[model samples]
Target chain A: MRPDRPTADEMLEAVEEFLRDKVMPAVTGHLNFHARVAANVIASVRREIGQSPYIEADQRERLMQLLGHDGDWETLNRELCEDIRAGKTDLDDPALLEHLRQVAVENLGVDNPKYSAYARLKE
Target chain B: MAGGSIDAALEAATRKYLSATGIADLKRLSAGASQETWSFDAPTADGLQELILRRAPGGVPESRSTAIGQVREARLIQICHSHGVKAPNVRYVLQPEDGLGVGFVMDRVAGETLAPRVLRDDLYADARTKMAGQSGEAAASIHNVPMGELDFLEEITPLQQWQNTWNAYEKYFLEWSPSPVFDYALRWLKERVPARDRVTLVHGDFRNGNIIWGPEGLRTILDWEIAHFGDPMEDLAWICINSWRFGNIDKPVGGFGRREDMFEGYEKVSGIKVDPERVKFWEIFGSLRWGITCRSMAFTHLTGHDRSVERPAIGRRSSECEADLMILLGRN
Candidate 1:
């Protein structure tokens, strides 16, 4: 990382603040909507950067245990999906269900923390 | 039609078809994935007419096989309207000489189309009470529309629908990343694919956002671009999808009422018994379908087909569907 005063996440925070406070207020119609979306994108990126490492690491370990063998995150995920599609993995496996649910909840946390399902599940 | 203003073409077309002197307030309406909606007022000999023009975006013909296209959408609305469904009356389909491209103009029905407002606004409190029941009645009426008249629509069985959606997801997976949750949901759907009890006209996109309502109740159903022949339960299950609930998770039927209320209204209209199991199957299917749609829309952005910011944002919402799917699968 560069020795910058504003780090990546900090820069994103500043951009999000500008978008919400400066740009959105001045815009109208679709532009206002787009500005809101832009702010949200920045927020999502910040959350993903902060949270995804832990989430993906947890998911990787779970997948390793469930599948009994594993590679990296993408490879293991692809293998699990393939097994599911090809009927190699038992559909009613409790471990599999738990893994899927945990991953979904974790992803939703980064994608949209305010999503109702995630909030309800968190509660 | 490309760069030129559509004012002359619209004026000429209305004059020829509706005997209107001219049109005013030709403003673009908001939020359609593959189509554009424009609201205008026409002054005819009879009176001033509020009309809406729904057309393909940029006058380009919809090449997507999933969409039934604007012409067919107009016809579907017309047919449903004739069957006492709360649908808009199609006034005139634009001709080739009209220079307006592929679309149809219809008499605009005044109502709030925004789902958030319909769900939360004080004015729509009464409407919310009646919406699910009315939605059921509307679905029944739509289903009751003679299938013989809708021969033009594509008939997709439950398995076929699943295959098509899965194929779409697979394409996305190949180009992007595999979603294990989606795969799991698809497998679950395949394992419990509902039988085609009876084939009927399925409003493939029947959800909260596609409906327009007023304080009294449902004024109109909009966006028939994906009308097809499928299991009637698809419509019932579709509206019950958790995503459509818009945070009113307890009120399953479009965030306003119960599934029982909706089923009751449907049964009252069509005299057909509601099958909860079948609806449940389709509800799961609906989540997967929506997830795939979210990913597909995001791919449009990722691939630079349409770089709208909203597209990638929606792509992230695939996780929302995954979360909903996990709940629906009883695994949460």
Candidate 2:
């Protein structure tokens, strides 16, 4: 006898129902540990999806265009990360900080007052 | 209990306790990085009651407590509560025979202690007005706590505290990452260590997040794990650290009120004027201390004892401490 195959949405619904009803109830040892497990699972999924070359190339192009950078995007990201890790580049650096502010505003789809204030501080 | 193995032990303990008093439902609460906190519902023959249980994880830093055992923490909490400090009322200390490892049960107070919400929530919009007044009063109350009354507390000379902290940081750095920034900060700190004026019972983690705020105002001060005998200014300086200021760097006291207001509040109650220069010295120490703590967390992850993204994120916050160093050194 063959087993029935569920649609994608149905499978997702079934998994959600199982987690809410059966799985979560049994795993009550430590709340923080359980939350960490859930977060790690989600993070792993995000990492797997983020590793696609097409997605990476698209993200890089978007970032470079936003920053108005002609150099390689990966190198720019590495430099930015290094700068942030060290105390050398303040989040208040004018040109780069302004570009970051614009990106955040556009991504969030809101004219956030906090970002505006942050941009002004950078200036 | 869903897990049947521990159920028998729980039942046995419950029965033993029930002979004296009824044991209500046990609900596990949020555990901190090193401790497990649980809310125990205790029902007497009369009614439902709630108590908090704190248990230590197997491996933790030696600096967390001066003594080797968990009973010391329970005793300290009890002493703090008895001294009229707004702290949890410790009820019972669980011995080793209690099936549960080492732990203590205390009366749980209702309040918010999370940092971000305390800083940004509209519910606490008026916190900016009241925080300085509350912190001042709380600090005065904590400082007024007579050290001689507590037999369990160790008395150390005020000046020895600097050496003790320096030694702890040195050990912590050797165990973790040996960042040059920490070395620079330590060198600067040793040169800048001020003369001690007076020693008081210091709440080593005395800051915005450690205090619980409720509808009744400040209900209880939490986390006495790092409590020690030190200069009173250490508490004041810990409160002024930029990390505890949340995102609002404007207000020095938990980013809620002016430094002058906090000073005036403490001065009025304690009858001792705060030394600005002395507080600044401790404030620098606060940054260095926190930076070391971040490194220790990273060590926990690297050693394969525990792995969490949050730990590494906390390690990344050492840069903030470096920024604080720059600000303190007049380089920013």
Candidate 3:
């Protein structure tokens, strides 16, 4: 995997730059709109690839402490959902609120850091 | 309708209905999964008329259970227009003889519906200043439509709406892209379902993008597909949803003005004191509802119902709603 000069993220950046600087300017109508969206999508994927490992590790640690147990990422998340839906968790609990806030903010950092709410919070 | 040319049929039908010699410049504008919009002009006894046709493509039935079908949507506009709501003017509904399936023809109102242009463009500065108050007044008028004439619409209780959306979201996203934020918001909403004593017509999708405006101000309210009978506060809060605000997040009323101005506008028209608490509750609900809608859109991509890149991109927006929920719930 390390045998290449252009890495995954770099390749994605090249594609995104090409779309924005070249392809987008060369297109019109529906294709123009979709080209912009495609460029944004590539950017989003680059962000997700760079950020997911750290974010997921943080989320797993928080979920484990909140639930007081150990499990895989998907299972732990599912259990948390069930607990909240079943009224097992207190909505007003400070720890729970902090955990939810941190998760929302971190995921938003990967998904769309420029979102108004996320950007305002980051500011 | 199947074997015949749709263009010829449409022209023939408009000629008889509008007393026109012919129709010209007929063009398809856009097509959603269930419906098609077309624009054309007719030279008639009354002079040239600019019109829009909203119809199901090839007579395909509506897929969304929540939509009040095209026929009923047109009638609702006619009723609201009769009540001075600035709704679109319906010229006529396509008859069976027209072979055009279920649809209606209406005069095309000139205005802007795009949010960014309306919010930031210099052309709409005056309109942007007046939009929130006008939107509030229009919503008030819509909520005041007499109940006797609305038997055709469904009356959805708050719990019914919440449960149906939650169930559908759970079915689609539980195994795919679960959101703990959504679960938390759902519980928060369930525990605080506001008690309602007044049920009125809720323009289920009233927002900036659904409205038509110009420099002079609001022209016409469009898109009645999801109109129903529900809490009036739902309409008030829906316009304030963060997603509708575009980038002007500070301006909560459709990214144009303050909520107080909108509330004032509603009170002046409806003679009823607006409740801020109920509006906040529905505002949170609106955010969660949109989050669920984003999940559903993503599901369309996953399940191959629609494989467009836009679907997954919208799915990414669910996190935006989650971030919005955190802020709304004071967790931020």
Candidate 4:
């Protein structure tokens, strides 16, 4: 139903290019700051779209194993938060720690891959 | 905002309080959705004066959050200024007849509030070394503010504030989905609330970006809307929070100087020894609070309260906190 040549990622790339290369030259001050932010938003959207499925699948598997239950991503994550809050889950368990670390790192990949701390943690 | 009307209002308010006949070069410097800051020149009989106006727009209802609203914020400036704390001189609070919203006028201190310029620019190299200790001395002065005179500032312990923020964040964020790292942070913070019995004036948001500095050194601390009575260590720890460091994470004290320097400065001014454990606990507490704050930025955007590009962009930074929290927990 959709043309595949100009995919969602490509569309975002085009918009970012236009904003950075074309529109950016004409703006200054607060609007310029916001323009860069707008461009970054599009780039983030592209990353999120490309990366979310893999990240979510990995998270779902970890949550299911750690919580000993099967459910959708949001419901299980909500339960995980509640368990940790109410002292039902042990934070020090090796499996649980791995799950948390991987989840945090994967999300960082989508959100801010350039966050300087990430490089140190990965190493 | 009608510029002419505001100028007229400024003249009237200043004439009564500052004995100024007129204001010139009036301009709005920055305005959030709720508040506005204006810079202007006021001509008194002696000479020209630089002044600032911080105000809510007309007819905007007052927010009941723990923020020390405008008039009282002015009071903090006045109190600190009187005590030689390098704060601006609060000149006048707006009256209704002045046609301006509720706010106060103060002497505009000249310095750079921008973090990038204050950090990377050559003009601030000397200021950088001096900033951390200056920040500590400044905090000591703020904490030593007379207790009786600060009756209006909210007197609450850090633990209570931490719990309130954690609970609010849980309801706001956790209901949508689970946040393992955030929940872990909350539990960890609850267990280690600093064992401080005495209450002191706490500059609730003392951080690098909010501080004003120039070539010489730290000039003044700004944004006292959330000043409160709390464990003094909360202020000390808050300055060391990673978010305030910008990207210079190596130097924990506001990304400019050593933590020991801050302690030395604080002890020098107040003659009270800092409990290292208490500062450490508050540092963890600081990380948790900042992590929660980053999450709120996303929620604020999602709820349509503020649809700025920065909102969702900042929402992404919630993960940055999540990562930092893990590191702090020694999970790495």
Candidate 5:
């Protein structure tokens, strides 16, 4: 059990551990190599958060929430994260791609061509 | 490395060049992802001089090399100086083989380049009134850069030759970014790509920040990285882009002068009548282009190449451009 408002570092570390121990090992050999690298990235992100635990925590939380989980996302709360961590998710998936688009637009409240481009990709 | 060691290295470098024609007291300036600017006190044989050293950062965009490099910039400075365009004098360009990496030393022109400071400073209060006249003159002079002399830019198609600048944005976005907004803007832009006008050399990044203003008038025009032979109206539209207005939405053309003034200035020098529709087309394109540029900045942040608050803040400005585009295309 975690606090109602876990720090970004704590969330990041938990996500990293889950990805490494649970997610990475579950992937096929085809994706295992990529998963290992991704795991290292998660570890690096954890190290960065060790320097500043709270900076961009709001943005991080917003990112997690927009990914469809809110509050105390203990370990890779969404299926998309699990798939991404395992390197099993297709980058071309329209739904997942749209989710990424929404996150960018929601975080930065701008309606520029980039957003318009993303919004029209489903068509 | 320790601060003392860096300082010692800087001091040694400064002393090595002290007797040169330009100033040489080097002060470490803030580091940018693409370049590092150093402010230095330069004393020439003639008089005191302020100088700046611009060098590529350890990591820079690969795409940048195709557009403008130090060698090309030096050539542009030479051309501008000969034509009486207010621009910094290029003093020296260190070759790539030189241990300094890609860079040049130039005469540091005085005046505020920052938009907020330009708007707030009392010194420039009256200066704003003269901006229209100065900008007009400067633009005309820039447009008059001898086409025959600029052989390297022969590959750039003139305005009438280009149907859409959107393709450039599309290529950059598809190759570099995962942002979907780029795709959307591409579709919108493609649908509304305007007809071509007469081609002329375009000052690709001509706008407020690029122009230095002094008490007398426009002192220098900087950043010739994107200078290309394209529609002349491209420069006009770029100058009027809302983002360069710097929070001053009412007064376009960098929040200092009217579009008519800029047109009048260019007309006087180029001996060509300004086309209203052509300028309007580029104006819309300018907003679209800048919107894509903002996403590219955001992509840099997202990709973790650089993670500055300024980059993401700039990403937020893309929407302002979208609204502008909507109005331009009559969607709003």
Candidate 6:
């Protein structure tokens, strides 16, 4: 990778700007609503591109430690859910609660950083 | 054009039922992905009359799980109106020959259905004070609609509803990504499933958004699409859900009034005691349901079935619901 020009994030920013500035002004009615939604999707993509790797790694570390398991993220999570459902895991385990909270907060960071719930948790 | 391309068919149809000499002021007010709602007028011998046409346009079937069909919806409204529920009177049910897919025309009641306006706008200042109490009063009335009349509605008990929902959500999180919080919530809810205190018609989606109101107060409970038989507290609790509070989080009853007032209103109307514990259980259940719903909306966006911006944006709101659950469960 030659450290490319007009990087993906930059391109995403450009596209978001174009939609908000140029295209959004001309539309009205339902299309206008969809256009705003489209802009939001682009913004979400920008956040995901920026934040997903770290969030995934953070969650994976938490899952590995809490579940006492070392494998892919999805597999470990599957085990956690199955164990909880089958009564094999204790939901009240303090470590488990802390892990779930942190991972959920991290997800909110990516998914909707603006949510008031996220703000309350940050405080 | 007030009278759009469908005017000829509408004109003929309005004449048969409304005794209209002319039909005009027909405009497609909204064309949703699944349905279209039109506002129109029939110039009857009496005078210019405003009525609404709510129809599921042809092609993809406009239906949902066990919801009453549009024809049956009209009948339900008629039944409610006749039973003294404040609902728009159903004027005519569409026939196949009417050229509308399957819908009914009803008298358009005067009120704002938009939530933000009803909550924040100056016009509803008095109505705001009355909403929580009136909401409880209205729910009592809706619950009293005779069981015989609602044979068409689905009967889903709260226990059954929560169990099925938990199983589905469990399977989804297992396959997709797991949340120990959801697991803990599930186990907690299972351990605390309240014995059915009362069974009546539950307005499965009762909330501020479903209400049409004015300065006087609530005119009708709209969107009876998911009406079912269940613990009546399910409806009572649903209105208290934080998401429905629309940022007015302090007020437990639809962002307008307190739980005490809601209970007071309900008890006065139905003479049935309101159980706080049962209501609390349903409130938690409502939060979990909304969290899952937010995920499903995101799933649709991710899967590209409906690429609307709103869906994924709504999906991100799952955290808000989760946070609310934490508060409800007193985990904080």
Worst 10 residues of 2 chain B by lDDT: B1-10
lDDT tens per residue, model 1, B1-332: 43338888898999999999998988877546589878899999999999998889866787998899888888888888888888889999987888889999998888887888999999998778888899999999989999998878989998899889888987876557788888888888888887776999998888898887889998888888888999999999999998989899889998899999999999999999998999999998898888888888888888888889999999889889988988888544
Over B162-195, each residue of candidate 2 has an lDDT whose tens digit, in order, gives 5666676667654443443455456556666776
Candidate 6, pairs of clashing residues = B2-B26
List runs of model 6 lying over 4 Å from the truth.
Answer: B1-3, B59-63, B167-174, B298-307
Name the candidate that leads on DockQ: 1
Off by over 4 Å in 3: A1-3, B1-5
Off by over 4 Å in 2: A1-123, B1-21, B58-69, B155-161, B168-180
Q: What is the lDDT, from 0 to 100, of the residue B24 in candidate 5?
A: 49
Candidate 3 residue lDDT tens string, B1-332: 34235678778889888887888888887766667888889999889999998988776556689888889988999999898888999998998888888899999999899999999899998777888888888889999999789789998888887888788777867867578888999999999887657999999999999898889888988888998998999999999999999988999999998999899899989999999999999999999999888877877888898688778888889889889999899544
Task: List TM-scores for all candidates, in order.
Answer: 0.97, 0.68, 0.96, 0.94, 0.66, 0.91
Model 6 chain B: weakest 10-residue lDDT segment is B57-66
The residue-by-residue lDDT of candidate 6 on A1-123, one tens digit each, is 236888898888898888889888988877777777778778878888888888878878988997777998778777777777778877667777667666567766776666656665554
Instruction: List candidate 4 stretches off by more than 4 Å.
Output: A1-3, B2-5, B59-61
* lDDT per residue as tens, model 5, B73-188: 67877777887777788766655444565666787887878877776688888888778766766777777877787777644543322333455555544354323333443444
Candidate 5: give the TM-score of chain A: 0.35
For every model in order, what is the number of clashing pairs? Answer: 0, 0, 0, 2, 17, 1
**Candidate 5 regions off by >4 Å?**
A1-123, B1-24, B58-66, B96-98, B158-197
Residue B195 in candidate 2, Cα distance off native in Å: 2.1
Across B1-332, the per-residue lDDT of candidate 6 in tens digits comes to: 23366778778889999999977778887765445678888888899879888777641246566566687778878888898987678889889887766888888777988877887999999988889889989999888988887787777776787777776686555566666667667777888888775678777888988888989988888776677788898999999998888777788888788998988888888999998998998898888888887777677668887776787777777777767776665445
DockQ of model 4, rounded to 2 decimals: 0.69
Q: Give lDDT tens digits, candidate 4, residues B225-299.
A: 888888988889888877777778788888788888899888999999988788877887777777667777777
Give candidate 1 misplaced runs (Cα > 4 Å). A1-4, B1-4, B31-33
